[model samples]
Target: TKPKSRSLCMANPSAYNYTTDIFTAAALRWLETGRTASKPFFLYLSYTVPHAGGWGSWPRAPEDGNPVPSDLQYAAELSWPEVERDHAASVSYLDARIGEILRELERLELSSNTV
Candidate 1:
């Protein structure tokens, strides 16, 4: 069945460290759930790597109480400041995830249609 309209679900802000399931699942749902096939659709993703508010973000601290992965891309360099390296690692991790999403969109043939 086709959906009459698109929808949004607002999650209560919490310190939960959700994994890629948070992102990939939503994209899969939008693509496979018949919500936007053969019609115009829009998605808004405000990534949180740069967001200062942890409680208001999706990828908060791990809901399972585990520490966030260092996501280090520069671990080979032992001379850099920890804070700077960690921050870069986080951004690098995010970029890779975004790339995955983009590749998925292309696999679905939705890349040209997406903004």
Candidate 2:
């Protein structure tokens, strides 16, 4: 059945991580359920990393602070070059998490037949 609305279960309206987390959670849930154990599944994991604008604000503090600004706040205050490094770091973190999920699939012996 088609979704009646864009919002699916617990959706966060304030950050991109929320979207990425939702997709990752769904994928993990499907992998956990061995019910459709034999069927080939196509997982379209769309992540929202590295995309600026919409929802989060990036600038409310100085750019040269010790701890640095929060991810959302940093993105808002600085220019592209300044924010790019932090954005790249955030993407790297997401990639690592996704890699871990893939490793889990391989461990379950569901990578081949379940793909």
Top lDDT hit: 2
Q: Which stretches of candidate 1 lie over 4 Å from their true place?
A: 1-21, 35-37, 53-78
TM-score of 1: 0.52
| lDDT string, candidate 1, 34-86, tens digits | 54334656777666564443233333334445444477453353344445556
Minimum summed lDDT over a 10-residue window in model 1 is located at 6-15
Model 1 CA lDDT for position 75: 38
lDDT of 1: 0.54
TM-score, prediction 2: 0.53
Q: TM-score for each prediction?
A: 0.52, 0.53
lDDT of each: 0.54, 0.63
Find the number of clashing residue pairs for candidate 1.
3
Please report how far candidate 2 places residue 65 from its true position, in Å: 23
Q: Across residues 1-115, which tens digit of lDDT does each residue of candidate 2 receive?
A: 3354544544653342356677777778877877254777777777767574433344354445444455556455554444645776777878976986789788776778654
